[model samples]
Target: MREHLEGVRLGGEMEEPRIRRAAPYRRIAELREDEEWVKVMGVVVEKKDSEIVLDDGSGLLTVFSDKEGMFEEIGVGSQIRVFGRPMLSVGKEMKAEIVQKVDGLDFELYWKVMEEVKRLEEEIR
Candidate 1:
């Protein structure tokens, strides 16, 4: 039993360090953009059958995702960080093709904003 517990502890210690090291790359990707791609951090504001929209304070941008399930699970006002490439729609609207959804915020302000968005959505429904 003692040996087994030591093995479990060692496994957890090793895994925790790896997860921590990988986190910076994820956050860096959220704020860096290049000529062909843009990284953004914001809240999910709207979602439709084919697109998801995010409001990043600078502006509202639509994101197209082929995986509908991944898109559907994200709720409005949920703080998210996304990395994607920008493209122009036929009508000249800008859009992003999302590659990832980073973790959400956990502060009191974030919770309050999420609540307000949920209430507004309920009203619209």
Candidate 2:
């Protein structure tokens, strides 16, 4: 049986979607067909009727969502986190299942730490 988590929290940290940390973070340029699901954080650069583009300095990725009101809170310059599946066709793109605006996110710092973690993990092997 799972323990009740009614008021329990971690290190007094803000509540966040668990999967946001569970999913591996991938840069816009690193996303490809091999990944079944991914987590990407970037600034919104473009928005079309059913698509939104994100840029993470690595590259640009077009995210398509058919859900109504999906982009309601997302806009240009908004820092957003996305969890989705990527499809590789002529070019790379993603179909997001969850998107949310993130506050107080340090994009550069986060990426830097993640990179170091990846490097250390690879070195362990």
Candidate 3:
């Protein structure tokens, strides 16, 4: 009985460490806009070769990077936090600079959104 109890305690201890590691990312959504730099958790909704589109619940913003190598591991459905100036393009499209992806969480949200968009497009056809 003592051995079983110790095993259960060990399992609980392992889970707590993982939860604590993720706690910092949970606070990403609380960032304020007035701050010079803001960290936001967002899903990568679009990836067009060199460009990436991140959707942080509010809206989608485009990120353009000259270093395409940085984007090799990023997929359409990845979650990322961008650190840079937000600007409006000539076409009034909003975008961010110096974007970085969040690790561990699979880009599942991006895949889900992409599937929905594809379904809608098919219906329109």
Candidate 4:
């Protein structure tokens, strides 16, 4: 009885769960066959009814969405951030879960910040 409550509080509370995190950002060139999820930011190089092609400078990736009109508002030349799972196919492809347009971003500064964040994350690990 007492042993069962050793890690539990008097009010039956337990440790709070860690906050769930979204996918990590990755350059298109860094995507691999084994990658499950990723976040990517790129310019829209092409746009179709259900898919859009993103170019992050390193490479191009195709992002498909099942929702109708997902790519309707997104046009070529627009910068966007995409959260999705990579496709299992041979080519560079992903199934988009969320798409967000990024306006007036400084690419050079963003890259620098992202690099620093990655370095910190690696150090923590």
Best TM-score among the predictions, by candidate number: 4
Clash tally, candidates in order? 0, 0, 2, 0
lDDT values for all models? 0.54, 0.86, 0.55, 0.87
Which pairs clash (backbone N, Cα, C closer than 3 Å) in model 1? Answer: none
Q: Model 1 residue 6 lDDT? A: 72
Q: What digit string (tens of lDDT, one per residue) describes model 4 on residues 26-88?
A: 988888767677899999999888999999888999999998877777899999999888884
The sequence of per-residue lDDT tens digits that candidate 1 reaches over residues 19-89 is 21111111222333333444556667887776777765546667666665656666777776555555543
| Model 2 vs truth, CA RMSD | 9.1
Where is model 3 more than 4 Å wrong at Cα? 1-38, 89-97, 103-125
lDDT of model 3 at position 59: 55
How accurate locally is residue 114 in candidate 4, as Cα lDDT from 0 to 100?
93
Model 4: lowest-lDDT 10 consecutive positions: 4-13
Against the hidden true structure, what lDDT does model 4 obtain? 0.87
- Which candidate comes out best when scored by lDDT? 4
lDDT of 3 by residue, 13-67 (tens): 3444422121112122243333443334577788877777776665556666666
> Residue 87: error of model 3 in Å?
1.6
Q: Counting only residues 3 or more apart in sequence or on different chains, how many pairs clash (N, Cα, C under 3 Å) in candidate 3?
A: 2
lDDT of 4 at 77: 93
